[model samples]
Every structure is written in C-alpha cells, then in structure tokens.
Target chain A: GDKVKQSPSALSLQEGTNSALRCNFSIAATTVQWFLQNPRGSLINLFYLVPGTKENGRLKSAFDSKESYSTLHIRDAQLEDSGTYFCAAEDSNYQLIWGSGTKLIIKP
Target chain B: GGIITQTPKFLIGQEGQKLTLKCQQNFNHDTMYWYRQDSGKGLRLIYYSITENDLQKGDLSEGYDASREKKSSFSLTVTSAQKNEMAVFLCASSIRTGAGQNTLYFGAGTRLSVL
Candidate 1:
C-alpha cells in the first residue's frame, strides 16, 4: 500500500473557478508540505502545515494528523495555475513520504 | 530568500560511465537531500546528509554515492550509468528539524541521459 496517496490524478478547471486537491497518508505524519511544479519544472513551495490550516493569497491548505489527510484548495483559478501539485508528509523519523501527484490544468 | 544551485543542468553519459552531480546551497541549511524523478513518476529519495561529512542512504541508494564535503555543498555520483536510462535529479535543502517541521527548498534539477 502507498504511504501517501493523492486524489484525482488529474483535474481540469475553468478560469475563475475553484477546486480542491487532496492527499491521504497511511503513516503517522507529523507535518505536511505542498508544492506546485510549474511548466518550467521548478517546484514552488506552497504551504507547510502541522495539523492546521494555512492560507496564502488565493490558496488554502489544511492538514489533519488524526485523519491522516491533507487538502489544498485554489480560489479564482488562473491560467498560470496550471501545473502538477504534490503533497509530502514527514513521518516520525523526519523523512518525507510523497504522493504520486496531481496534474492540474486551468483552462481559459 | 536563499537559493539552491545544481551544476550541469543537463548531463549525457555512456553506459558504464560514472557521472557526478553537484549541489550548493546558500541557505546554510543543515540537511540536504537528493531525489530522482523518472518520467511520469513520483520523486524517489536517493540519499541525504544531515551535516558536513555525513551521509544517509535512502530507498534508492544502490549504485549511487553521495558526499557532503562542506556545509554548503553536497555531491552525488552514479557509479555506473545504465543504457537508455533517463531521469531528473533534484537537490533540496531544509533547516534542521528539532520540532519536526521544516520546508524544503529545491534547485532547478539536473536532467540525465545515458546512451
């Protein structure tokens, strides 16, 4: 079984729309980090959470340690938001377990 | 903000040849990592260093050697390139985690091709 699993392997959203991405962890994760890999292959850090929620501009993320899951929500999606999203969890040993990833395409 | 620099944005090598990749970070972070990403696959950890002169093997450490010669730099060497092998190697660094919470800063990555 995968230690970290991301939902909706791919997503398509219209500009100005809102959508959510999710990641579930099978291990006892202590912290979680989300990243967006742009077309240029640069992985931009989005959020780092520990059993709580954090918001940045048009993005919001939440991590639930007890439930072993994390969610990333995008508001007012734009063309530039198109890319692959990844969520990684840090376990007790301080090692990261990454999800396969979700490819998102925001159409204009 | 600090930056992580990876040398040789692209690398081409022959089968059985040993290739080396270098990473330098200006963040002065204590932990550095190396990950391999194949086309359409998730990133897999190859090796990590907690401090200078320290090395830890990850799940995919076989055939790979890593060294942390200094606090600001880490290097990885592929003992032998396999024919038709292709992948992107990513380098990342993070602050020491005493509370178990730290975010990783990544470099642009180095694409490797073996003929």
Candidate 2:
C-alpha cells in the first residue's frame, strides 16, 4: 500500500473557479506540508499544517492527523495556479513521506 | 529571504559514468536533503544530512552517495549512471524545530540525462 496517496491525479479548472485536492495517509502522520511545482519546475512551499486548517490568500489547507488525511482548497483559481501540487506527511520518525501529486490546469 | 542553488542545472552522462550534483543553501539550515523526482511521480528521498559530517539514508539511497562537509552545502553522487535514465534531482533545506519538521525551501532542480 502507498504510504501517501493523492486523489484527482489531474484537474482542469477555469479561472476564478474553485477546486480541491486531497491526500490520504496510511501511516501515522504528525504534520503535513503542501507544495506547488510550477511549470518552470521550481517548487514553492504553500502551507504547513499540524492537525489544523490554515489559509493564505486564496489557498487554504487542512490536516487531520487523526483521520490520516489532508485537503488543499483553491478559491478563485488563477492561471498562475496551474501546476503540480504535492502533499507530504511527516511520520513519527520525522521523515517525510510524499504523494505522487496532482496536476492542475487552470484555463483562462 | 534565502535561496537554494543547484549547480549544473542540466547534466548529461554516459552509461556507467559517475556524475555528481551539487547544492548550496544560503539559509544556513540545519537539515538538507536530496530528492529524486521521476516523470509524473512523487519525490523520493535519496539522502539527507542533519548536520555537517552526518548522513542519513533515505529509501532510495541504494545507487547513490551523498556528502555534507560544510553546513551550507550538500551534494549527491550517482555511483554509476544507467542507460536511458532521466530524472530531476531536487535539493531542499529546512530548519528542524523541536521534535517535528518545518517548511522546506527547494532549489530549481537539476535535470539529468543518461545516454
């Protein structure tokens, strides 16, 4: 079984629309981190959570360690938001287990 | 306000050739990591160093080697390149806080091609 799994492997949305990405952890997760790998291939850190929800601008993320899952919601999506989103979970050993990723395309 | 720099943004090597990728971080982070990303796949940890002169093997460290002689730099070496191998190597750094993990800052990445 996958230690970390991401759903909706690919998503397409219109600008100004909304969408959500999810990650399921089979291992015991203590913390979660979300990152966006842009078209240029540079990864940008989006949110880091510890069993709670966090919001930054149009992006919001929540981590439910007890349930072993996390969610990233994008509100009012923009073209620049088009990229691959990755979620990583920190296990008890403090090692990060990564998800395959979700490829997002926001069309204008 | 710091940046992680990976040298030789691109690399091409022949089969069985030994190639090295270098990373430097100005963040002065205590922990640095090397991850390999395959097309449409997730990042796999290769090696990580929690401090200078220390190394920890990740799940995918089998065919690779890593060095961290200085606090500001960490490097990964491919012992022997495989023919038709292609992947992106990413370097990241983060400060360890208390007993948990912190946010990570990654470099642009080094794309490798083996012929």
Candidate 3:
C-alpha cells in the first residue's frame, strides 16, 4: 500500500548507456516533479510536469495521472549524472508525497 | 535566480536537548516548507507556511515546531533531540501563483547528530 513507489532502488550503468527510472502512485497526483541529489548533497530540481511529457537536454520525464505512474529517462549517461533521482507527487490538497529514490551510478 | 540558504549546515546536540535550524530565502516566495530525510527513506514534510504569518503542520509534525516569523525566513525547532530522528533536514520555498503550485526549491540541507 505504498502511496508512491519507485522501482529499481539502485542502478549501475556504463558511461554511455541509457536507463529509465519509474514511480507508481496510489494517490491522485495532480503534479509531479523530478529531482537529483548530487554527490555534494544538493537537491537539484530536474523537471516539473503537470500530466504530460517534458524533455530537458538528455533528460526526459513523463507523468500520467490516469495510469498513476511517472517515468524519468536518462540518455547517454555521463559521470556527472551519477546520483540519486527522486520523484515527488502533489495531491489535490497541495501536499507532496515523495518516492524513496533511485540510486544511480554511471561508471566511467 | 535565487538561493535558499540553511544555516549551520551541520548540527550536533545532546539527547533530549533543544536544537534549532534556520532557513533564509531571497526569492521572496509566498510559501516555505520544512522536510526531514532519513538515510533510506524519502523526504517527509514537517511544516509549511503559505503567507508571512501562517503556519500549517505536515504529516511528520510531531515533536517538531516551526515558525514563519517573516516572509523571508522560517525556523524549525527540535523539541527534544532524539537519536531516532537524527537525519538531514531540508528547507524549501515556492511561489504559489494561485493558478497552481509553482516549482519547489530546496536548500543544501542540515545534517543533525544526536549524541
């Protein structure tokens, strides 16, 4: 009965491979946001979605409230992208529920 | 084009002692929030303020107190430093445009140590 669940808790990839991280929610999510916690422990906002898809550079994300899931795809992974990725969902009451996170390590 | 700064990046206290963490934002946002993050657990909201003098408790508000003394600053106090709750505390802020919730920005976070 997890409100927000993230799959593949941890991931390891070669420098140039691609991968996808997923989040499934039981709550009626109104919005979704993706974040990256870098090695220095800085929580950097990567993407914000309402109900569709968005692409920023090599990072792309999609949120489908109808299906109760979200996805973040990383293309051509690099050493700098080695960090933890988290997805947070906002409900109708304007409260956020966070996914545990996906620890990604892009090996050189 | 703003920054959220959390003071005393690291906090250490004796068990059952009172500890305080401070957050200041230059974005002049309307909403501010406090969240606690454990090692493997995701971030959990503790408190939030919509306006200058308003305060609302989040899911994990127990044993924690927060203050929105002004529009630019918010402070959180640990009623009693317990070893179980020793983790990183994150402070964030966002502007509510009335249309919807805007992007939430977070600080570097403060790591707490209970001795």
Candidate 4:
C-alpha cells in the first residue's frame, strides 16, 4: 500500500485562506507532479499533471487517472505560500512515486 | 533556464567514512536522478541515468554507488557512512524520457551528516 498518499500532514493557512492538497495513488498513475519545498530547501516546480486541470498564478491542479487522485489548490493564501507540499506519481513503468509531504503554513 | 548543481551544500561524514556526492547539470539533460530525503520520509530513488554510461537502480539501491561520468555529470557514492546518517540528498534532471517529458528539475539539497 501507499504507492503515493499525501494529505493533511500539516497545514495552517490564513493570509487569504483557501487551501487543498492531496495525492492518493496506489499505482496505475499516468503522470502527476507538484512540488514546492521552499523555506531555503528549494524544490519548486508546482503542477505537472496529465489527467486534467492545471492553473498557475494562484495555483490549482488536479489529476485523476481513473481516480488515482491528485489535487493541489491554494488561492490567495500567501506568505510566500509557506512550504513543504509534494506529490509525485508516474507509473505505467515510468517509475516515480513519492508522497509524504504537505506542511504548508502561511500565517499572518 | 537550467541549473542543477549540488555539491557540498553541507556534508560531514565519519562513521565508516567513504562518502561522495556531486551532481551538475546545465540543462543538457538526458535523465539523471538520485533522491533520498529521509526526515518525514518520501523521496527515495537511489539512482538513475539514461544516457552517458547509463545505470539505473532505484528503491534505495543497496549501499549506493552511481556515476554517469558524462552528459553533464552525476555521481553519488556513500558506500558506508551509517551512524544516524541524517539525510537530504536530492539531485534531479529530466528532459528526455517518455510521455510528458518527465518534467523534473531540482538541486539544492545535499545535507548529509553521519557523525
């Protein structure tokens, strides 16, 4: 189990409120990538889905390869948008399955 | 718009010694990766290469030892060093792989400390 599963491991938002981040794939994923591990750790590269949806400025993403799951949405919530939030998946032999993050904390 | 240089961002080994980590990429990517972040646990894919010298082995890849030698460089070696062995070693690059182009470009990690 847990080929890739991320959820409210941590989140605090406030600045402008509105948040959502998730990833759930047990395999069979086609493609999904979303990252943002700022806070000096640098790992930025949000959204790279394949199933559908994709935005930018305020962030918005969604990928549902037959419900394998994948979603990340955050609007207005700034403070530089906090940190930690990863979701990676790419099965079908492409390999790449990682999810154990979601620590955003945009206060003030 | 390409830069993935990771080297001694901070690394200190001792326990058993033998450590080496270095990655350089100026785009010219062909596929290169080596992840291993272990705090909250997630990124794990010991090695990968798809061009110069090619070599692939993920899922932790044993004691670890990788080298791509060319195409912009990629090297990782930590044969021993294991004593608490803190983690944080990520180096990625993608520009040639199947579908979607496997977009991945990261490098700003290499915080190992195994005193």
Go through the candidates in order and give each one's DockQ: 0.79, 0.87, 0.77, 0.29
Model 1 ranges with Cα > 4 A deviation: B97-100
Model 2 Cα shift for residue A55 (angstroms): 0.4
- Give the residue spans of candidate 4 off by over 4 A: A1-14, A17-29, A33-50, A54-59, A63-73, A78-81, A97-107, B1-14, B17-35, B38-42, B47-79, B82-85, B88-112
Residue pairs of candidate 2 with colliding backbone atoms? none
Q: What digit string (tens of lDDT, one per residue) describes model 4 on residues A1-108?
A: 778989988989789989998888888998889998988888988878889999998988989899889889999898998989999998998888889898889989
True contacts kept of each: 0.61, 0.96, 0.75, 0.71
Give the per-residue lDDT of model 2 (tens digit) for B1-105.
999999989999999999999999999899999999998888999999999999999999999999998999999999999999999999999997785658899
- Please write out the lDDT profile of model 4 over residues B8-29, one tens digit for every residue: 8999999988899999999998
Q: Candidate 1: TM of chain A?
A: 0.98
**Highest lDDT among the candidates is held by which one?**
2
Q: Which pairs of residues collide in model 4?
A: none
Error of 4 at A13 (Å): 12
- Clashing pairs in model 1, backbone N/Cα/C closer than 3 A: none
Q: After superposition, how far is residue A6 of candidate 1 from its true place, in Å?
A: 0.3
Worst 10-residue lDDT window, candidate 4 chain B: B94-103
